[model samples]
Target: MFIDRAVIEVRSGKGGDGAIAFRREKYVDKGGPSGGNGGRGASIYFRANSCINTLFNFRHGITIIGKDGEKGGTKLKYGKYAEDVYVDVPVGTVIYEEKDHKFIGDLNEDGKIVKVVKGGRGGKGNACFKSSTNRVPRIAENGEPGETKRIILELKLLADVGLVGFPSVGKSTLLSVVSAARPEIADYPFTTLIPNLGVVSSKGGESFVMADLPGLIKGAHLGKGLGLTFLRHIERCRLIVHVIDMGFSGRDPYQDYLDINNELKQYGFGLSDRKQILVASKMDEEGAEERLSEFKSKVNEEIIPISALTDDGIDLLIYKCVELLKTLPFFPLYDSEEEILDHKVYTLEDEEPEFYIKRPESHLFVITGDKIEKYYKMTNISTDEGMMKLITHLRKIGVDDELARMGAKDGDLVQLCDFEFEYFE
Candidate 1:
């Protein structure tokens, strides 16, 4: 199965919680806080693998979670950091963020890697808070949560030349004769369902990759027939070999040429602008010469005549393709600068408040925000000193003032995530 696209869920590992402990060894007159910091979480990355040709393995939505870091220990024993996860995908695969449809990275080259999600940072231990004023601080932080995202992977075939035309126009036949590839071919239309790749070498030792792509119908650009399913494969082709059936299919060769080129123009992505070589295929058939002569009169460009079955004019076609490829420039599947600018950017000035107060019911207040939620998760409120330290930090951030502004009275109920507390002025 030639699976070109897939959607998968990926998650980074969570950091380990900081330990809150004090020295209790013998002969120790004064024992201060000795809690160690938590370990960092594992990150998720995507690497390119040249060996893989398809994304068939990732058909179902798979969640790739990184290993969680070990918890901190007493006596300043830091937790162990988890290893990062690296996923291997086919070369020329493009990754996109599913939610926003933003371009994440393109694995155009082998061994190319991009960080998909960053792991959460480890929390600080109580030892980090100890100072001249507070030597026996009891506060310890919990581990931070990792990032989760749904990403889409799309594979684009890398080929030097792409053969495109209506179905059964001798594309598969041409590929089979010119190279070692054995694509399924039959007399019926749409026989070549999947894109087939082959390597053709000239007599002068010049070689180039050629792809026998799926046929393009009139409404192919609008997703009719093979449609956009295989259109992406053509984007990488430096040269397009427009294979036309000369009076064989009883279809007008000129009209077929116009329809196919229109589809390319509609699809965009610089495909219509690429240099094309016109080929009047199946030249052995009767009336093929007359049709070719007429097609030459209507079309201003040069058209090569070839018969894949008899091996007539095949060698010259290969030589012509190799020569043309040398002068053609490489076409990129995506614009790097445009994709980079499309990604979300953040500035310090755009930062929101640490917490926001919401009154869902009378005598009830809710506080929520990124910074506040992180602090709330890290707070070890079981200890009185820890709870006081958290309260002091909340006050410093104007959470108390925000609550008062929202008509929060003394002794009222306040909620932070799942935790609830009695408000006090």
Candidate 2:
């Protein structure tokens, strides 16, 4: 299976917590806080691999998690940071944040590494809190949490020219004759389920890649056929080769050409504006010559007449394609970073209050703030020193003053996050 798109969840490791300890020795007279700090968390990264051509490797819902950092030890010994994790993807893979549709990075070159998530920072140890006035401080902080994200990965095939036309238009046959790619060929429509890429070298020894895209019908832009599924592969092509079957069908070659162009125009993304070469296939058929003449009269541009079975006019077509490739500029798959920044747009949302104080019931006060909630989650309230640190932080941030202004009395019940305590004046 040639998979091109996938969705996966990734998470970075959290930092280790700080340790609190006191030095004990036989001859040492003065021993203060000796706790060591925790180590930092691991980070997640994505690397490009040219050997892999499809996204099928990530078919399953894989959750990538980084290794956690080692914990701190006694004697003020800091913990070791964890190693970062790297996931390899195929070249030309583009990643986007699933929720907000934000563009993360594009992996266009092999061995390119992009940091997807950053690890959390480690907390400070009790030794860091020691002061002259305090003398024997016993406070230690917890490490911060790592980042988590869900992203979408899309792969676009890298090719120089793309062959697009209705079904059974000698696209696969032409690819087989030009390069080593042997796509499935049949008389029925939609024979080529997936895009087939081939390398063609001109007589001058210049080589370029060509892609045999799936067939496009009248409503292909609206996703009526395989065109909608494989149209993305055409975005990277520098030129388009429209192969028209001039024999064996009741459909007019001229109308068929117009419908395909209409679909390309509707698909947008500069596909219709791309340079195109018209090739009328099966010229050896009985009515092919007459149809080719009619098509030529209708369209003023040069249309190459070819019979893939007999290998006639294939050389001239390849030569023309190569000549065009020399002058055409390479099209980048993504927009410039400056272009993205210049078109800035803001998302409006209801502004949240800095802090909220509410009384769920009589004498039961609830305090909540984004910052305070995060602090509460990281605080270790099992020890008396931990509780004191939390109280001091709240007071420093004016939370206590805000509570007093809200008619909070002495010994009143106060709740923050999941922890509850008695309020004091």
Candidate 3:
């Protein structure tokens, strides 16, 4: 259940609506609007938790939503704000904007938190819009909508050195001897299915992390053996430890080294650029001296031959790894603010008001926009009072002028999206 990658949709909360009320005290006569404004919506954030190692927590989830803000109250009392939502992930977890594939955050340090989505701002009440000329205004704004996004989370294990070789090359055994990591060891190929990490400390008390990646076969890049699954886990490593079976009893050590290198090259993810160390494991077996000499002649570099069972050459390898760690820079990767998104609210008032006219059988009209929809949905125009209210609203929004410009007459028929009306003075 050590899942490393997941895709989930996230939505921030929407702002609350503004309240519309008037002062009704007995002592005060004709009081103005006393309504309160709405509260702000909840934000969405992502926090890094060191205790976690996988993205399994995000499983079984397709979307996450934050709470909406509370509505405004009377007597100038503002509504309560919604609580923010938090998504926790393990260290080394990278957040990417799935739509654009942009990097957002790198959870390198423990307890680091980053805001992924900001909540919508609350709308103002009619009371705030009241003026000396318009003291009894009955206008109020609705709540703003929240932001929605789709993001991808990926995890890469952070380590100092990565051990890579062909199957059954004693990589697990080397790690078991050098560090405290226990990996499944056997004679068969592809014994290590997953990457195993270990912490190796030197005599100077300096320590570094090492990972035992799965064995790579000749066609690893083409889905052979472990395929390219374990190759991705080693991209974050600083050094590559080439553990060849210097016992050279079964295969040529030089050819094995070249074969693994070629796989990394084919993968082409900056793995070959990393610092590599030459170490031949299983040297205790007979006829190892001739193989070691031949391998040295071919490689022409310093090679450490180790016998993991006898605990020989373990300390020297640890020391060499530590020394290499000191010389290299403390390489750190970072993410920028461009990974997140900005939230915006859209309202009908801001849209272009357009109405259509057609003569399918005869002349007909169709109107669309913020004001017309409000008159259709909120007005009960079957009654004379409702009809009067609709006319007053339409006139206030300049609907009559628009109809005249479109060549409408007293006998013409008018329509607002789905409603039809006979024109009159």
Q: lDDT of each structure?
A: 0.88, 0.85, 0.77
Q: List the residue pairs that clash in candidate 3.
A: none
lDDT by residue for model 1 over 246-292, one digit each (tens)? 94798999999999999998888888999999999999999999999
For model 2, the superposed segments whose C-alpha errors exceed 4 Å read 22-29, 130-135, 201-206, 252-255, 286-300, 326-330, 335-338, 341-373, 392-418, 421-425
CA deviation > 4 Å runs, candidate 1: 24-29, 186-188, 204-207, 248-252, 326-330, 335-344, 347-364, 369-371, 396-398, 409-412
Cα distance off (Å), candidate 2, residue 57: 3.5
TM-score of 2: 0.81
Error of 3 at 391 (Å): 15
Worst lDDT run of 10 residues, candidate 3, spans 330-339
The candidate that wins on TM-score is 1
Clashing pairs counted in every model: 0, 0, 0
Ranking of all predicted structures according to TM-score, beginning with the best and ending with the worst: 1, 2, 3
Model 3 spans with C-alpha error above 4 angstroms: 6-9, 24-30, 54-56, 62-64, 97-102, 130-137, 149-152, 218-223, 249-251, 266-269, 285-301, 327-425
